[model samples]
Target chain A: MAQGQHHIIPIRMLAIVFGLLLFLTLATVITAQIDLGLVNVPLALAIAGSKAILVALVFMALKYDNKVNLLVLVLGVVFAVVFLALTLADTELRGTIGITEPGTTELTVEPAESE
Target chain B: MSSTGTTLKHYFVNHEQQFDAAKLGMWLFLVTEILLFSGMFVAYAVYRSWHPEVFAQASELLDWRLGALNTVVLLASSFTVALSIHFVQKGENDKVVVLLLMTLLCAAIFMVVKYFEYSGKFAHGVFPGAGFEPQGIIDGKDYSKYDIPFAPQFFSIYFVMTGIHGVHVLVGMGVFVWLVTRVARGHFSPQWYTPVELTGLYWHLVDIIWIFLFPLLYLI
Candidate 1:
């Protein structure tokens, strides 16, 4: 056998993770039905995030895999967050930047009118 | 040389190196898949933030029970795929074939449920883009009541996201069927199961994407 020949994950651990995932799914549904004001989206995302981590770690066997693979997965997730955050920053604050100077607009307008 | 010298290609030094390279490639591919879906998630977030009430109301037209059922089905499929990998490691080819078939069955069930959900929506003229006309009664609620401004955007995103995800499910079914055939032919063993592991990773990622989609599209 080779050095990395086998790493059989116990069936019990897989079952436990599967159970937890189902439980979290139910929890998210119950929470969503209630009006949680602004916290609803974040709460649901948090639950989903945990479930994703569980799948990646146990079911996918990243926990027992090589470090480089884990690093690759983490980088992928980090870039995804960067994409989400940067895009949201722009869309969420579209009009709040106030890039237009109050007097500059009028000055340019006057020149254009005179011409 | 590794025990399965026939399985190791000439370019690779040993089975371990080949496995590492293949796994790395799969991870890179998974990264691309993440970014591919991220674009849709961003679109969803921007639109939902703009029309929170409309998205909320529009999402209600979706039956969360169905969404949750598919979620359970996918989670179970992911579990079975994981077990198949475990069995492959132990050289239990029969168990591996059975598990892959089970995973394939789950994928088929997921698609069938999606078919029902999509048809139900289309029957009400609830389509993406300008075709959206929420008429007819669903779950005893008047669909016409949901025809608010920007509701079309909500449905458009819904259809596009789930539609792409559904396509992935179909592709997974094909992959599993092929895998099952190979397993029954005794092509994989403890020393050479790269394809099985790679496909399992792909399937798990498909499941992970739905984990987020279920909440974003159906619940919240």
Candidate 2:
């Protein structure tokens, strides 16, 4: 391929990524079924994140595409993380008065009676 | 039919510039899409953290098996879309058409499964928002038992997120249908197949969203 021409990914590489995504899907399902305490959420998120990245990089052809496009994606993701982080920081810390008390508060919605 | 290819627009200096510009525009749109879905993700994170137990209990009402099935279906569709682009780049219109059809099939299958899942919830009176009511028991797991506070929030988020995602899937199916007709009419070729490529990007992004949604919502 020429310098500016589209890079054609091989069929084998596409198949490989497909297989990896499917494997990860199964892995996340199985891992979630297992009792991993606090590890489960993060592990599931990590696996899901991996699957997203794989789809973005390979299937979306961001790997061989323009660097500017990749920059756009990275910036979007960064801003998303920032958005999540800032919002979480506020929600997680709101109403906390003392330094010693960690704000692990729950919503005070009264538990409804079972009908 | 194979002889026809996209003509370069007057503004773009060359085919590469045109392709790059088109792709960049699509990426920007995709960024907007990311931000759009990010709002819901933020809601999910905040709510789940506040009511972890409620989220856990509410999530049990969802069938991870169905979620996993849809995840695999979406991934397979994404792969087919990639393959279609591959063949389009190779000027193999026949294979491209076939792959796009396969992609459409997968998308349809996803929606069908989602329909069943949604209807199943509705049948159990597990509606979102003000209609939040659950009745009876299935498989010995009483739906009525899960009618706790913040449980509605779980089902609400589930409905909104998956409902919006399902809309995207339907939209993707429509786009693929159009692309199928175009591919059949030989509107794409190795020289220029921007539409096919852009559609693939959109479809893959939809798949990416589901990847997160599955683990977060169903796997809990």
Candidate 3:
């Protein structure tokens, strides 16, 4: 191997990132306990996304690593998002293409009561 | 070049090229890992949206306290793994071994907690698919009331996601044990700690997936 210099992350920085991650975990739990109605799922996901980014960027050393590696990760994430969005588009819109107008119910059975 | 004690492979011009190639390969592997989990995530999304109320009520049966505990456990393990990489680069094999041990311990704890949670659910006869027959009382709550339509789907998704994640944890533990042995034998140095670095990245990805799973399965 060529004599390549490796960047040593400071102990203090690692400690701080760890602390922040723990704090965010606590935040997500507390926020979940409260009823946020429409914002609940998005809120939980946002917190998770932030935590994932921190782990990827700092804990995994992507922040200080080569750009090519970062590009690989970013591409992976982008494709995952594409997979989600396109699939959801199809699933969520199932049976909505009829000429009798969307939102029309074909089955007369009442939906089961939940809870 | 002799000062660093780093060996250059004949196939590569220098260590930087070799390191970059390895790192990129790991990232590609990580991408496949992400896609692998994405299929489950898609299933989760489709089912949850289709049966929001059922998903919500069924999720309530899960103990978030245990989930939170595991979350903390995984995050701490991820921290220790990261620290291990840092120490490896500093040529502190002793610290690396200790940190790797800590990471392994955390993974064990997470699995143990999961075992208890699974046992509790099983005791109530709550299972995925056709086997679901939730009965008896758990934590003063009546499990018998969870027989609503689409409830099975919720439990199915839950079991599949967590079960796979647990398997990953086990795999990580195996890798860490191997790493500990290698470190103890003085096999790693500041010059070539690629295994430690790659293993850390894999562990962090495990942690990241759990970060999403915790909220989606337990809190939501």
Model 1, runs deviating above 4 Å: A96-115, B1-5
lDDT of 2: 0.91
What is the C-alpha lDDT profile of model 3 across A3-93, one tens digit per residue? Answer: 2278888989999999999999999999998998999999999999999999999999889988888899899889989999999998889
Question: Residue by residue across B38-155, what tens digits does model 1's lDDT show?
Answer: 9999999999988999998899999999999999999999999999988888989999999999999999999999999999999999999999998988678999999889999999
Model 2 clash pairs are none
lDDT of 2 by residue, A1-82 (tens): 2112578899999999999999999999999999999999999999999999999899998888889999999999999999
List candidate 3 segments past 4 Å from native.
Answer: A1-4, A96-115, B1-7
lDDT of 3 at A56: 93
User: Lowest-lDDT window of 10 residues in candidate 1 chain B?
Assistant: B1-10
Lowest lDDT 10-residue stretch of candidate 3 chain A: A96-105
**Model 1's CAPRI class?**
medium
User: Model 2: which docking level applies?
Assistant: acceptable
Q: What lDDT is reached at residue A83 by model 1?
A: 95
Calculate the i-RMS of every candidate, to one decimal place.
Answer: 1.3, 2.2, 1.5
- TM-score on alpha carbons, each prediction: 0.92, 0.92, 0.92
Candidate 2 per-residue lDDT over residues B199-220, each given as its tens digit: 9999999999999999999996
The DockQ of predicted model 3 stands at 0.59
> All models, DockQ values?
0.67, 0.48, 0.59
**Candidate 1 chain A worst ten-residue window by lDDT:** A104-113
Which one wins by DockQ: 1 or 3? 1
